[model samples]
Target: MRIRRWSTVSVAAVMTVALAVVLWSSGAPQGGRVVGLGSVVPWGSADPRSPMAPPPVRGQAGPVVGGLSASSVGVLVVDGGRHQCSASVVASQSRRLLATAAHCVWLDGAWRVDGATFIPGYAAGEEPYGRWQVDTAYVPPAWTEANSPIEDVAADVDMAFVSVLPRDGVLPEQVLGAQGISFSTPPQVEVAALGYPALGSYDGQSLRGCVGTGAVEAFTRPESPKPSEIRSLDCDMTQGASGGPWLAGPDADSGRGQVVGVVSGGDDTHLVSPRFGPAAKQIYDAADTAALAATAPAPSPSTDPMSAQIAPRGGS
Candidate 1:
């Protein structure tokens, strides 16, 4: 069972998006390194590695790897690196949008306000596209108002989007290429869940993935505010892999795909995500609108949305 600090007593087995990042951080992380805006920052308590639980298997997930697809997907270090989660760039007009789990942006009663940095193509301490700072976040109001996500209604809205400050006047999407997103897709379909897993049998160094058929999942707790049904599939990704993207029709060459869902919570056997629907579109638009109204990034030929579409977003 994935026990966390949700309550005074333990509950059923479920690996939450931000569960282990907050619980198992006591162990010395893989490499106590601090990175900010592409430079290795001074090591201290603010180190993002401090929050990651050490890999349990002598790196059983195999050697570190990197690729173009990983350019749009990155690790999110928030709250002064106290929390680590996965996130990815999503196609949008403003070219600065990213989708992740609501809990990754807001958790334990408040938003993570200290600081948040997104590192794309991070593998073995290498920052391929450099680090981008998160400027604003937009989450479902229903998720924020819920005192506890123990209810289906609240859990179903556990998605969020954030606008990141561009580097060198170029938006992230223009540099890494963004992935198309769809909200009307059905639950049952083929999917490729990608992220950086930092736990037993895996190492949080490179881009990792699991391919499977995804379907709707139901929560039958039989209580008031019972859990809502989410998308589930056979996957072993855990903890740091949260907020990772579930890609549909993934391209093996370009590493791009249409995003359908994100990694939310599941057990050792499978993973789950909020079914992207009207609510997701609402928030996506909200974030996009806000970014559009902000300062424009340095223009490039790839500014056209169709020019550089490559990867999808996630949940953590």
Candidate 2:
């Protein structure tokens, strides 16, 4: 199913004042540590607005379709400043790129151009392998404008890819590896969405999956900034699931699911994503190609090992 987008925590269609636009229309975290990386602790009441929290990963699906058990696994955490979101490695162009939402790493407020960390296959609060530093981040041109949430579109532009310096002497494949990405024109017969939501029905620590029937929604661009022709579904998930990929094709569990939509933002009850469409397809293809162009240091072509970027300031 397609995810929804509303600026900040509220999914309403109305355009609120900039100060009130703290969250993305996708209901993303306004401020916090980037995913996977530890969030900074506050000196006072712990900043109730914080989004990251250590919780257990969901295993009910037992690594089945949409289940949270596979090598394509990784984490996305907000920064302590609550301005950006960083993602772990699933797969990459020569293991150089890390995928996430555009809103997750753009300059918004004072948090603009802030640095983040990436830890692939992280477990139990520890970087089992090593810590990788984020280098440069890329976002869509549309997101760089002032219109913002009012220009929302669940297209590829919503996605962002970044380069990183993996732990010394390691290629991405040598480490945890990466997940395959797709741009198949939406409405895949069936698919699943996965993520590690630190709130809601999720336990925060473990990964969770949800099955949903996908179909493309068509019409014209809405007056709002949200996307059109999103692959709609009815899966119930909460915050922290933002930027999760809507995968199709085969993997550890479900087979033959290609990733089409990404968790963008949602309505009062559901999450929204930029549907896989011509626009999304173009962006992803470009990002992948761009990653391939990077002169990532190649390992001595060794095998067996594990591994691992972000920014974008706050909203309103």
Candidate 3:
């Protein structure tokens, strides 16, 4: 099974416009703040000859192979079915929270609010766990109010928290399970970055991943005013992989790891993510708090006459 190709051209055009806006607003360099040190995870030695090494293979990057990692990450579709970005289920008080890059949800001075659905465990056109609608998205004010797209400032707050609506009385976390989230952990942590990159060799149907040690690097664009520290690793993940999870800890395979960062952007050789910091924590706290006030009951599943008659009873 395969999902249709997403409109990469349209998204790229929009991003280009956003970049122009940022460049036009560029000014004097600003100092960046340290988010905090991340806890180091022993992921063994880095393999230089591994496929996850530098000089990534275009389009031949991440292809979902199944496991707890595949089940936790999903494609974030926007504009009523167009594949947009990647997202993951993260542990939160509401059990309905999702984490992704802020630019994925909000770009060009506006938010992509309607017709958003998260297909967890989505692979080869099969939605293993089912789809959940996004009810709300939360991003930091810094990202929303920035005059220019400062790399460091953007890296500092390039994150968003999304609230998912339940389907058939089942929350997304209940169906797909959730990964723990952490902030201010040490750098050079071993992690598994997962996503559905739609560019190059990827068709956006299957899940994909790259495992390596992630370290914080300061990035400064020629048009930008100052440098920003972003978490980076030698992964070949491309555009469609944006907003994917950077999982850490020894139990990453069992999906028992903490999400230290999200896939923000990267070149052909490396992937970058904004470090999970105080700003990200505040957004998560707000989303979890809002979830407590949502009292809507889950909608009942639709009944199909022919399928109901032929379907087996007492089965999931």
Number of the top-ranking candidate, with TM-score as the measure: 1
TM-score of each: 0.73, 0.62, 0.70
> Residue by residue across 49-80, what tens digits does model 2's lDDT show?
21222112322211222222233444544343
lDDT of 2: 0.43
Query: Which lDDT tens digits does candidate 1 get at residues 115-229?
Result: 6889887776678788888876777766666633321223456677888877888888989888778897765877777776665544566666776677776543223255555
Least accurate stretch of 10 residues (summed lDDT) in model 3? 16-25
* Displacement of the residue 137 alpha carbon in candidate 3, Å: 0.6
Model 1 vs. true fold: TM:
0.73
**Model 2 stretches with alpha carbons more than 4 Å out:** 1-70, 78-92, 107-113, 146-156, 219-227, 252-257, 289-316
Best by lDDT: 1
lDDT of 3 by residue, 1-316 (tens): 1111111211221111110001000132222211221111111221224332322443234444545666678878754453357889999878898988777666656566467778887665677777788877777776676522323235545778888877887777777888889987886788777777644444455666777788776544434455555676777555557788888988763344899998876555567687887767877776666655556332113322211111011111
Model 1 C-alpha lDDT versus the unseen true structure: 0.61
Candidate 1 residue 175 Cα shift, in angstroms, is 0.8
Query: Which pairs of residues collide in candidate 1?
Result: 152-228, 179-311, 242-316, 243-315, 243-316, 244-314, 256-310
Instruction: Let me know the TM-score candidate 3 reaches against the reference structure.
Output: 0.70
